[model samples]
Target: MEKKRYYNDNIGPIKENEVLALKKALELCNEIGDITQITLLIHTKGNTGYLERIFETRNLKDFFRGVKIDQNYPPLKIETVRTFNDDWQGKKIVVAFGLRSNELHKYDDYENVAGIIAHQWSEDSVKDWAQSWGAIDLKTETEIEKTALPDKVVQQAFIDLTNSINMTTGITHPMDEEQCKTYIRALKKYDYELNSKEIFSFLTTELNWESDNANDVIKLIDKVNSGGYFKGGAKTGLQHHIKRWKSK
Candidate 1:
């Protein structure tokens, strides 16, 4: 009897049972935060199985629908390089995503292919994704030196604000005073850990701000976790202000 085959758009042929198993495995990986990287193996008739790891960084949840590749082959990897300027500082974060075995030279449009597979194939899309990921969208140092924002005070304020929030918090920008107070109160009320998905969900459902995009809630939560205005808690003096706002 011929071996059963399953099909997916990107990965081609896979065993149906294998697909189910991979999906279950992916779920478990994500739950435990082991999903920082994922690899898919594809098996096709008349061709050796192909291994690929497509998603990178935050692109996992955004682009990865399911691991549709076959499991018969070992995981293969190709390098993808992303170079973009930071929002305010013009710094660059070089991100690498992988491609399948021998797929690099198969086409002349390697750059575009890598970009699409990484879910940030376009320049504009890359900028958007980077900013959403909290990469500071600032002018480069050279640009700032040449055409510095006229107001030195404002420039310094922005610099201070950006530096205050820790990078590990995954926040690229700072929230305003009122927004800061609201976030803190919610944090205290729900007793949710800073930057947790629970806080993200609460902000999405509870806040009635003008920006209601679910993604915005996540962004704000990122700022909160990065120490935003509430950095160092009461010692930073922001807690006093937040307390006053809560009273109002």
Candidate 2:
């Protein structure tokens, strides 16, 4: 349950080649007043199940969200330069990093490209950033503060968390406490109903809980759905579960 470290030298040393590439990319952004295309050789953490969706979206906002970030941050348009990493045999992915090159500029709304790289290029940083964005370890079953944040931002956080879940490797970045609460609250507030599969998916993938732990969450949800005596009804089920888990 320890928080993952991002922006640290945890992904092995950044090779001289990668540093040079990063420098070149940064230089291009400075010259063009936008992101420019630069090639990078990335060492994979393991399976590459999530690369396609990440590239398709061109941003990690779906998996991680930030607030009050540097507005002048340069946006990036990324593509896979190659699938093979020369240094690691075939385990790494070669990616092309660039400024926003697409016609649609919707994905360009981010703090900056450097911040994005800190998350995308490194696993520890992704966890660290997630922590910064208000994710918590579900195992702890802690309370998630509403932060008086706007509803839209919380909703987006839920959506992004789901998107990341759909592409998780089961051990990379897990949801934080705030994210867990946001998702549960959103579920309760939804006009429609959610099936068991949907509920299970959220617990297993989104929260990255083991089967037993996920089942516990489902039971808590069932208790809430059945109209328990909690003050706010099912919306408070999460808190009850947290309290019980903590007591045990």
Candidate 3:
């Protein structure tokens, strides 16, 4: 099956305004006690390369952990790096980068990942998914940075506001086990040979699940298969269940 494309426009070079916004967002995350890590979501490989060059030029690559490239549906390239300032002694913030259409749910897999920075052109669906999982939306957070208040004051206010609304608790896997099993069964019925990317597409387009939720189901499938509880793992873990469902 042909993979569905979430974004159609080619991302241009990172603009100055975007850089300011990114810096502001990173600064906020750096100052807030609850947000020690962030993931940068981009839409294209060019954007990923642009960001890499920018980070390198700015000496931001010094904190890099690694990079991952996914050639599947909604193809993505990720760079995991850390950010810190001298003022904030003993504090280092981890920042990850990936395609916006990829697994927003995977943010939870990292420690202290309470923040997310999406490219300005990111779709509403992606932003909403991030918000639903309790990750701080950098766009919204950066708006506060625009205020005239002192940095410390704005940081404190932002902290208090997020705390009141419970935004700092970190990401959550909202899809339960049964739901995941159902999704797996659906995938088996769709095509037993489907790869992980195709399974994600099926979950999103056929099952009407948000991308994040679909990705959550995918992770659950991996976990169950890897645990050795399911025979044949992802290749055939729930074939028996799928056959029964198909007959019904």
lDDT of each: 0.29, 0.34, 0.38
lDDT per residue as tens, model 1, 197-248: 3333232222211122333444555666675644422234445543443354
Task: Please report how far candidate 1 places residue 32 from its true position, in Å.
Answer: 34
Instruction: Indicate the TM-score of model 1.
Output: 0.21
What pairs collide in candidate 2? 5-124, 6-125, 35-99, 135-176, 136-176, 136-177
For residue 38, give model 3's deviation from the true position in Å: 7.3
Q: Which runs in model 3 stand beyond 4 Å of their true positions?
A: 1-12, 34-48, 52-98, 120-125, 134-248
Full ranking by lDDT: 3, 2, 1
**In model 1, where is the ten-residue run with the lowest total lDDT?**
141-150
**TM-score (C-alpha, index-matched) for candidate 3:** 0.34
The alpha-carbon RMSD values of the candidates against the true structure, listed in the order shown, are 18.8, 17.4, 16.5
Off by over 4 Å in 2: 1-178, 201-208, 229-248
TM-score of each: 0.21, 0.22, 0.34
Q: Report the C-alpha lDDT of model 2 over 53-162, residue by residue, as the tens digit.
A: 33343444322221222345333322332332123211111122221111101111211222122213344333322232233222232322312222343334334544
Which residue pairs does candidate 1 place in steric collision? 41-70, 42-70, 87-136, 87-137, 87-138, 88-137, 88-138
In TM-score terms, candidate 2 sits at 0.22
